[model samples]
Target chain A: MRRLCVHTITTKPLSLEECLVEFPKRGVSGITIWRQALEGRDLGAVARQTREAGLDVVSLCRGGFFPAATATGRQAAIDDNLKAIEQAHAIGAPLIVLVCGAVPGQPLVESRKQITDGIAAVLPAAEKAGVKLAIEPLHPMYADDRSAVNTMRQAHEICDALGSPKSVGIAVDVYHVWWDPELKEQIDHAGKTGRLHAFHICDWRTPTIDLLNDRGLMGEGCINIREISDWVDATGFTGHREVEIFSNRLWSGDQREFLEKIAASYAQLYA
Target chain B: MRRLCVHTITTKPLSLEECLVEFPKRGVSGITIWRQALEGRDLGAVARQTREAGLDVVSLCRGGFFPAATATGRQAAIDDNLKAIEQAHAIGAPLIVLVCGAVPGQPLVESRKQITDGIAAVLPAAEKAGVKLAIEPLHPMYADDRSAVNTMRQAHEICDALGSPKSVGIAVDVYHVWWDPELKEQIDHAGKTGRLHAFHICDWRTPTIDLLNDRGLMGEGCINIREISDWVDATGFTGHREVEIFSNRLWSGDQREFLEKIAASYAQLYA
Candidate 1:
């Protein structure tokens, strides 16, 4: 149906209660909440409030940060991700997005193996919990310190190695992948394998200020959001186009005004 | 033979004369001078100075930036590139690096086609002038404003389509391509196909402040420079490992101190 979702991370200053109340008012059909917002908050209340708002939980905002210098540290990450899967389940989210962690003062080759093994270890619990693990391949700039899984093909390779379509898939975020030469082909491949579980929307701004928090609004950057939307639509998987701009500029703005602007921009650039 | 080259852009504040004097003192064997530096300067004198210093002009700074909004604009770009190729020949550079221009307020798909056409339009002239056009695929972050070519695979595909090893090849830069999932495989592919023309070295800082000027010195950032150097070596590429940092911090330091630090870092991390 080409539904639109608002990722609450875009409005980092907003409370979960405020987000639940605001999304429907702005015509968003779904919400993708960050794990940081969920922490220490009442899960039952969050789940009940989200359901009461009649919003779809497209995805829970992340589960993987797998690399570690020690085995205990790595095991702790896996344990934490297991808990994150449970939270996703309780909140009725279909997918728990995994941002594969990067090397800790080590080479990329060694880190890549850690990421694959970490995902393999978590796949069993994810299947049992009935939560699809969505590998969100971050931009390559984050390949060292953030996510080692920096390409769609790499994410899909991990999924294939794990051998569980029901338990593993990928979240395609335009901000992270718009520069990829193999983007269209990879998206098409994901569609053929039914591995495209989520579609995230955000723009990559020129003269980008901050590597982590300077994501632009949809129409403000050079990304062809509508064209990407069309490609995702052609996949025949009618899911929400989740707005996930991690901008300090937007976070400092009025939450209601920001969501309104996002809705307006989405309609203008992507509708 | 393993050699060291100084990308004059790294010390852009210094004049070509200053660069020529510094190179031999710093134990550098080669230089890649920018077109702007050669624009008004006596290129014949500069070439003679390079030869007297026993310096190899590995590559000319650039020639590509071809996409334009009008036919005249496009033609002007081609003309500029022709002049650039002439300058490259005068300086005894084996390659004229090309940063394929981006879309002019258009979608990337359209911009990508323009880049292809632009390269094709200039190839014959470049070949006639005896200059190898090495496409430097910038990081995707620059895809919107700086360059449309963002991957080695994309650059190689362009070369393949153009069908001329004499006219087209790739300039592999670690700062741009270190994050690529297929980096190792693509480097191997590029080496095997003899499309590897130039290799530039730099590091990607974790909290990249400014998109254009915040590059880290080698070993200061997380890039596995040695591994990439090994890969480049395995390709039978005996070209210079040209240091091409764009750091505001380094640029602000004493030129001798900066060069010494770079030499020390190169020896410690990549030697």
Candidate 2:
């Protein structure tokens, strides 16, 4: 139960205040705050509140959209990521998961180059703030507009290009990487290189209706979550298994029940 | 115009007879027949009609759903594939494009083993019929049920496992592999090994609405069709560039207009 964490986006309907009150009640010991949840709130107070509520601030939800067409666009993305680093620092969060961006029609190779440069631009700020950045490789379906970093190998390549910075690592999300034939080998390598920063749990539904928001809950779909979880643990990763789902179906229901189901699912998954 | 081939599924509204009439009218030189399009029809008559209509029968649309949960299911799949081989032989199609298969929740490693074994079982029949088999690696998005083979590298690995048989080769589909980083290297290797048997073309729509039925036409989405075509051609692949799309949007429209557009798209793309 203490290792159970949930992203704010999982319970999309809950306000930050509501989340602080509700998450711990449902046995969620950690919370990864989405940037939207921090709007108009005092970061220090939110940090204090999270501590008082007996919940660890796991990490900031996202911070990378580094690839763009123009220099101005790239600079703007860097500025946003810099701001994210500061925000993570303010909120007492130690990490930020990156959903690196891609231009729809741009060559992916070019986009990846821009991503590498953009991360280089942001690394100094992240290092100063003592906040790590976890590059979460999106599924290939998002290779057009959402991300060009669509595999752990690509993420590792970027990390290598950046001189293997200590502040930069990867977040392994099963939804994006479970289909990879080289998943176990890549995960093992990431663990060895100290590049494995975070772990996320979700399932891939068979008849996935929507590409973006049709993620299945833990036991609701066909993913070998337990096996993947075992691999992550085998790497000596004693971190929280963040429940980060982007599901239209689950978000439309009662969030309280959703949280309840998440608690039960985590219990069964780890048991 | 000589290399422009279209799968019958691309224009789903057209019947086999209709395809025989409409394809040559639009300057399409070849046709790949989907098995469903030949349902309850005489294969010999269909072959005669296609040839007399001045269109080459490029390949049978599919055969290979090699993964199943049980021995009975696996044998059924193999039996069905054998039937597809006979149909291809009868129809004068020199090849069969395999979609392969995966069982939900089955380890992909296990599914891949089944696929390799199933292909091995059917290879003698395919060779005896003088029909080549092209392994079409489906996108990882379809890894749940469509195929465990999701990259050119994996397809090559399977071929290598089967003792690198001449009858078994790979079909390179841009839609399934455009995002792959190792695509160029894999294509180059396949060409050198004489395993680059077929090439497929289609665009990948940005906001892909449906997984199974929302493929984009050439120039309709973000895929670099020309670039991938260049790579295939660089491999000395003089095979027909099969236009294989599965779009509900195009299927619901006037297929004559769709064919006109396909012709225009191909001209603009290759020009």
Candidate 3:
């Protein structure tokens, strides 16, 4: 129960303060905050409020969109990532999940090179801030525009290319990697190399309506979340199992009910 | 132009007879007939009509849904595949493209095994009919309900598991596999093994609206179609560059104009 974390975006309708109030009541002990939830708020006060509510600030929701067509754009992305590091530090988040970016018409290999360079550019700031960057390898469906890093192997390659810095690791999100045949092996490799930093839980619905926001609740879809969670646990990953769902169907409903459902599902999953 | 092939479902509004007429007029020299198009049609007559219209019957659109929870369901899939082989033979099609199925909540490995066994079960019939089975590894997004076989590597593994039969090869659909990092290497391996049976061409739209029917025509989206086609060609795969778009947006339009746009896009892609 202590390990159960919910991303702020999971309950998008709720304010950060409301989440602080509601989540702990629902037995959610940890939280991964989306950047959106931090808008117009004092980071220090938000951090204090979250701690006062007895919630661990697990990680910042995202910090990467590193690929861009222009040199200026790439540099801007790097600057933004550095800002994210500052934000993570201010909010007392120990980690930041990166959704490495891709350009639509650009070659993926090129985008990947840019991603590596971008990460390298920002690694110093992240390290100085005492924040770790967990590269969340996005689903291949997002390879066109959302991310160039779409596999655990690719994420590992970026880490290797960046000289295997201890500050950089991977966030294993089941929504992105469950379909991968090499998932178990990759999880093992990430563990062996001490790069397994975070674990995310979500289900993939059949007849997925929207490419971006149609994720199902834990028991509502076909993903073997428990098996994947076991594999993550087998890696000695004592990290928060972050519930990060982006579902229009779920978001449009009662957020309190959604939180209750998430808690129930999490209980059944671990039980 | 000689190598341009269109799938019947790409122009869903048209009948088999209408496709035989319209496709040739649009300079589409080859046609991959979907099973739906063959419904209620005389196979011999359809074959004759296709040939008489000067359109080559390149292959059958699809014939695999092997994974089932029950043995009866699995046997039914095998039986349907056998029927597809018969249909392919009757229509003078030399190959059949397989969208290998997946069962939701079933272990992918188990589904893959069923897919292998299903292919093996129907292989002798396919061979007897001189019809090659092209295992089209669907995109990972389809890994839940569409296919457990979600990469060229998995497709190759299945082919290898089946003793690397010449009758069982692979269908390289750009829409399904363009995101794979090992795509080039896998295609080369398939070529070296004489398992490069088919080359499917379609673009992947950035905001792909529907999981099943939102495929873009060549040059309309982000896929590196020409580059992937070059990879296929490098493998000595001088097979038809089959156009297999499944777009609700396209289907609802005036199909004649859509065919013209496809022709234009194909010309630009090759030119």
Candidate 4:
């Protein structure tokens, strides 16, 4: 019943060893590993260490950036994603969250087409590995370079384009989608289609200083986290309310204390 | 054949007199007046001065912040908007742009309801003064404190909720809406309903330095302005393609040079 998951990047200051030791001790039931956190480490051993501590490996932090100007660049991205699928398999993560990319100055429609193609290219590998690929729709501010898919509707369209394969789904992030007018309907639709593979939570600061690194902790900013949770929950998504925060401010602090605060905030929001 | 208008705030360094003189010399044929540009000057005299410069008064800069925590706060916003209507009337401006506000922690649904009520409360004055109210949906970045209307569809929905009054219309700004997947449909719908009252342009720069003031100049960033403009024109729109950029970088330079650059950019994109 304890379903709180924290992204490894949320505590960037902590080493993988630190996370393995600290996360389970905090009563946190799950961990999503960022690829950077495993650099030069033995992933199979890392998987054993993580599960040995009674923490579920919820997902790999990311595996996308599919839009590129050159065919070679795009193919490289697909290769990287295939490698991510292999890593996810090794680490025993059942899912890979994708920040499907956008190229600056490239047409989003073309980038979208490329994204659809990229995902399709990797679908067979994902299915072979039994790894679900969750397309994370980033905030629109990131439309210039981070993603072309900036809404759940577009994500659904991409899924439909890919034939709604069981291995392909969506990752709902509150920081990216809280302002959407069509959120309730989109969530219900994602649920009805049984493609809501992941859920992420964070708050939007009033004067978000940096688009990439200025996320607010829950209850510290303007998002109605509880209401959004209720909407996601209404769709029968009884999975990890995964905490995926990227904050320069939060990262510089005592990461253990910061994560304790995470537990506190998640508990208070869901209380 | 000149179809370019410039927002006064785009040249923040310039006085109203400077805009009246310089905008036309650069082949910019229209201007949208921000309330701050008027200061304590006589509105009627300012209107006469603008006309004397052979410039069309496109619209009053803004008048909407409907959502507040209290009934008293909402009433105060309405009172301010009514004053804006009077100013628009006195200045001979035919339209008043509405930013239709949001509260930091308030549910957007409640803010939307308040915005609808607030607009209805002002419809009679707007109708009497013959000033159309153009709902300019702010970008999702501003949804925390600027406006709950973040999409053209939402703007159209508000117009519909208000019974599609002749005085209520939507302003399409490419900066806020270029990322929308439903953009073409929304534009076509607004046109079909005869609610597309205004069109504005700018671009989205990669590595956008600041949220509030780092807007890209025309053709300086990634928006397919010509494509979007074609969409607007296809809907039988013949109004000025207003340049409403908010760039601290551009404003800090010589404003005259900036205006010329804007003219050049417009010519390149639209010619």
**Preferred candidate (DockQ higher): 1 or 4:** 4
Interface RMSD of 2: 0.7
How do these models rank on TM-score, best leading?
Answer: 3, 2, 4, 1
Query: On a 0 to 1 TM-score scale, where does candidate 2 land against the true structure?
Result: 0.99
Question: lDDT of each model, Cα atoms only?
Answer: 0.84, 0.94, 0.94, 0.92
Q: What CAPRI-style quality would you assign to candidate 2?
A: high
Q: Pairing residues by index, what is the TM-score of model 1? A: 0.95
Summarize candidate 3's per-residue lDDT along B97-131 as a digit string, tens digits: 99999999999999999999999999989999999
Model 1, residue A113: what's the lDDT?
Answer: 80
Count of steric clashes across candidates, in order? 0, 0, 0, 0
lDDT score at residue A39, model 3, on the 0-100 scale: 97
Q: Rank by DockQ, highest first.
A: 3, 2, 4, 1
**Model 4 per-residue lDDT tens digits across residues B149-262:** 999988988999999998899999999999888899999998899998999999888889888889999888998888999999999999999999998889889999999899
How do the predictions measure up, each by TM-score? Answer: 0.95, 0.99, 0.99, 0.98
DockQ for model 2 equals 0.82
- Candidate 1 docks at the CAPRI level of medium
lDDT of 1 by residue, B92-153 (tens): 88798888888635666666677778888877877887889889989877887888878888
Residue A154 of model 1 has an lDDT of 86
CA error at residue A55 for candidate 3, angstroms = 0.3
